[model samples]
Structures are given as structure tokens and as C-alpha cells.
Target: MQIALTKKLAEAVGVKAAFAQENENPLFSWTANWTKVWDNRRTEDMIVLVNNATRFTVAIYQVKKKDLKNLEVMMKKAISNTLLFMNINPEIVEEYMRLAGDVELVQNRGRQTAAWVSKAGLECSFYVGREYNGIEKMFCDTVGSLINYNHVNITKTRDEGFAPYQEMINALTELTGKPAYKYRAFELSATLNLDVYKAVRRIIVPANLSFERLHNVLQTVFNWKNYHLYDFAIHQGDKYDPAIRVVPNRECLEYDENAVLMEGHTLSEFLPEYKHILYTYDMGDNWEHEIELAQVIEDYDKESPFLVEAIGQTPPEDVGGVGGYVNFREIMLDPRNPEYKEMKEWARFWTPELSDWEKRPRVIRL
Candidate 1:
């Protein structure tokens, strides 16, 4: 795997004067490395800067060199994660990202080993000890997972849905006696209300996830992409208040004056306040998910979010909402129906993976 360090960190590690330039540069040479190459980042994978160190680890990244074309974006994301790990405000992180590499950073006590993000958007842990071999092991283990596969940075698992960067937050916990940021784990039951299909999913998510990401997790649960505008809101006495809605970034949207946006305010604060939230996606189709807070895990230390239960098939995106989907299901139930072939063909356009649309309802437990 290829790793290019900032000139300063390369110096701190004495990598500058180590091997002769004409000789073997094992740090950048995939063949000279002793560790097993689980994935490949043969060219350039990461731009890492770690002034933070603990008895356990040093901050490092494992970028998937092939998936992404832009290393600068990965670099900026790593820097933002580092700055955020140091308890810098989200707004300030954005400013730092805007400034880009012009900003010089220093090591902070907050992050004993700082932050890193792979091109696959994965955070890493480089375990170490006081012994010489321990440091060597850390380097080898960190680099070994750089093969073409996602041995290090995987966002989704078979059951665990959207994995948060909990490792980054808890990197300093053992040394400092607490995580860099406190996250509350929430057990949520999301039921998509349709005219016929009652799709349900039980999820466990960290509250620190932004509204935008929470929307994404819901999208995954329903097998729908974020193709339309969506928002999270609580029910008022008569109507759901737009004033209390949490939408995407204001810069990206023509936002309401009163709607809460991501970053400046994240789900960390708003999610715990209410037991029920209405997640509405596709304003035209108007698909509503009633999210009921089933349980709360205080001082949660789990590595990622997951889906514990799933039931019923979800209609594909833009199926004309409740009424249209009901008609589609009716047609599919009878093979002799004239619209059966045409309707199933159309559903395949939205869900390419499903072998048969006329099959039984979807059910999952994990």
C-alpha cells in the first residue's frame, strides 16, 4: 500500500533519513512490506497526520485508492474528523475545510491519536505499545488491510446497518476515562405507513449521527436512495411544526428561516428530546415513517448501528405513494391479470436485485 505522510509527520517518525531514496522505501513499497495485504492501495491511499498518541494507538487512515478519484477530499474529510475529535465546533471544522491545507494543525490532548478517514470513508485504529516490536506490529497491522477489499473500513454489515465512527470517539477513552464525545444509543422502531404494506424495521443508532445520515439509514432500511427531499420533525398539537424540522445543510437547500439544519445542530441534541419523530421522504409521493424511540442506551460504547428486526416488503421508490402501490400489489398477486407483466417489469426497474416481485412479503431477523 502507498502512504504519503505530511513532511512533518514523516520527520517525526524519522522516516525521512531512514532508507536511502534509491533503495527500498518499504513504507511506500507494497512488495517490501512484511504484513498480509488484505486490500490494495498501491498508489496513494491516505494523507495521515497524527500528533496524538496513546499506549494503545496512533491515528491512521486506510484509504481505498480505487473507489475514489480525489485524495484531497479524503484529506479534507480526515482533517475535519480530526478537528472534530479535538472538540472543535462543526462550523469551525467547515471553515478549516474551506481553508484546506493552508491551515497548520497542532496535536491536542483531546485526541491522543487524532483522526483519520479512508477513501472508503472508514476510520482506523493503529494499536501500539511501549515495546519496539509493538510499534512495528502496529505499522504492519495498519498497512496489512490495504488490499482492494474493505478489510478495514466497512460501513455496512450483514446485520449492523450504518456503522458510526465510534472507534474515533472512543480512541482516548481508556486513557482519559471517557470517550472524546458522549453518544447515546437509541433503539428505534421505524414503520413506513402505506395503504397496504406495513413495513417495519427495528434499528439501533447513535444519536450523534446527523439528520442527513439518519435519513440515509432510513433509506437503506427501505431500500430507497436519497432521491428526494426529506426532513425529520415532531408532531405538534394540530400539525407537524416546520419550525422544529431538521433538514439538510442550509447551503444546499433553500431552507426555511426557522428549520433546524445539520452541523450547527446535529441529532445529538434533538433526538433525545422526543419519543416520536416523523420522517417524511419524497414530498410528492409523501412516504411517512413513524419512528418510535423504543429504548435508550446511555453511555453506549458499541462500534456501529444495526438492524435487529425487519418485516414486510417496502415498495420501490416513486411507486406513486400509497394508492398507486396498492394497485401495483394487486396486479402482481394475479399472474393472469393483464397488467401483471407490465407492473412487475416496472417494479424491476426500481429493484433490480429482487428475482421475483410476486413473491411473499420480505421478513428479516438478525
Candidate 2:
């Protein structure tokens, strides 16, 4: 969906003929981070994004007609403006923008890979504390569509002396230090609630185990593919209201207040205070697992996580939920069932052993 700049606002932005042209002409030097889009007191015609630190308008798009081509042009303009504002080389930024617009070339390149198009270029390096894929996300959200894998390759070099990015990297490094959490180990039990049936796995994790690590651990134990968003809810009693949400990224922040970032927050920070927690995965599917302390093991000197016990097979991916899985099991068990052949072909996922310490511990990590 394209958000066109109204005639009045475009004039205020000091552009007279940009809308009619096949390109963008910026009369005002847009210094604000267009990615930091906020919707605080929005009108039908306009959207206001605020920069708290500077306390100023970032970008205000006045709505009118919706058109994809116009939006793409706006994005091209925004990308260049932001890069210029960041003190990046205007020529380099222009070149990157041009390359990024080439849909075929970008699609041929990596969607998510370590071997980047350019180093220091396409760097997940910080820009006003931007996280991984920050630029891509901003563009997608603004355009109300997914423009992934078509990201502009920011070729800003380390030689440019990006001090703020360097500082951010240093701070994040400090946060990732081992034994950062206030414990040696934890005895946590995760029980997958499948309505009529409950599949549980008890494991011992390192003190500094992050929500992200725990997410992986649970995925391994339950045989999930880790393809969806997940959140850990630390709540007190029967009600989940006012729960402390620990999520994978900023996208989840919109759903909860004062939510904790999973990367830095660890088990030690909450396990003691809140013995019981909820691990909710696949926001759409809503797979809710109850995670609780099985035994207090603050003194256990375990360097790596270990799965001591388990129950039930890995539920089929997107098998709808308990009802869906039960229906699947019923169909798969009966050889005479009409869908048996098709089900068998589809059900190739590894069904974890009831108790396989030898196999599980090898796969688990700190």
C-alpha cells in the first residue's frame, strides 16, 4: 500500500513536482531515521514518527491514493535520504540503492547467508541501535508488504570510523559474556500441552541460558524446526495479565509492554522469582508449553545443557494443534485408512525416543 504525500504537505516538504515525476526530488534534507516510524496521534491523512532522543519528527507521510510504484519510488528516496543523513558516502549510497532496486540480481543473491555481497557493506552493523535485518523490517512495515532479500547493501566501511556502531558492538559483546547470569545451572521442566495428552521433557541448562537458547533446546527436545516466533511469559498466578514477556525481537514489543529482549535476558533472572513460566511458540498455531523449575540446581557446574528425560514424539509441524495431532495419529496408525499412504509419506520427522540421554545430550549445547 502506497502512502502519497498530500499537495499541502509535499509543498511544506518543499517538493513541487515529485508526485508526477517518475522519481523523487527532496527539497528538504531528511536527516531523520525513516525506519523509526511511530504512530502516536495519527490522522487519516498523515502518520507521525517520533525520535525520543532528539524529540523531533522523523518522517510524516500524508496519505492519499495507494500505488505500489509510487511506494517503491518513496522507498528509494527514503533509503538515499537516510544514508546521506548518516554521513555515508552519497555516491556509494546511490550505487547501493540502484543495485537494491534490481529485483532479479538481489533474488539471485543470498536471502540469509554469511558470505555477504560486500563486507562492511550489508553489515548487520549498528545504525542508531538497529538490530539484524533492521533496514529490511523498517521498509516492509512502512510499505505494509514483505520486501525481504531485496535489502539495500550498505557498504559503509569500518575505515569510515563508525564510532556509534563500534560502541554498540562493544556493549553487546559485554552482554554476551559467559556465566553472565547469577547461577551455575537450572533444572527446568517443559511440558507441551496437547489438550488430552501432555508431553514433557526435563532438562538441566546453564545459568546464563538465554530465551533464544532455551527456544532451541525446546525445539530440539520437541523436534520443532524453529521456523516461527516464540515468547516466554513469566507470570504469577492463574492470570497471565501483567506477565513479563521475553521475546526474540522488536516485532513482539508491539504486543506487550516493557517486554524483555531474549538475547540478553537469561533464565537466572526470572526462574527464582517466578518458578513457573509459559513458552508460547508459533503465535498463529499457539503452541503453549508450561516451563517450571523441576529442582533448584544453582550449584551444579554444568558447562552444557543435558536432557535427562522425555515423553511423546515431535508433533507434526503445523499439524494444527492437539486435535489436529490426534486426528493425524489416528489416521497414521490405521494401515487400512485411506490417507495412510499420504500420511506416512509426510510424517518423516524424527520421533524422539521416550528416554534417549545418549542421543539428546550430544545435540544440546550451552
> For each predicted model, how many residue pairs clash, with residues at least 3 apart or on different chains?
10, 0
Poorest stretch of ten by lDDT in candidate 2: 103-112
lDDT of 1 by residue, 1-366 (tens): 123333333434344423222232221111111111224323433333322111111233333334234433443454456444333234444543453334222222221122322222122322112112321222212321221122322357534432222333333243244434344678889998776658888887776755755776788777786779887776532235533777765753465666666644555575666667888889888988988888887765433356767777788778798897888777877789998888888777543223343233331111
TM-score of 1: 0.54
Q: List the residue pairs that clash in candidate 1.
A: 38-147, 39-146, 39-147, 39-148, 40-146, 40-147, 40-148, 52-112, 52-113, 53-112
Q: Tell me the tens digit of each residue's lDDT in model 2 across 72-177.
A: 3554564455333322333444444454343110111112211221221122122212322322323221221111112233358545432332232233224343
lDDT of each: 0.49, 0.50
Please identify model 2 stretches exceeding 4 Å from their true place.
1-183, 350-363
RMSD per model, one decimal: 13.2, 15.1
Error of 1 at 216 (Å): 1.2
- TM-score, per-candidate, Cα-based: 0.54, 0.49
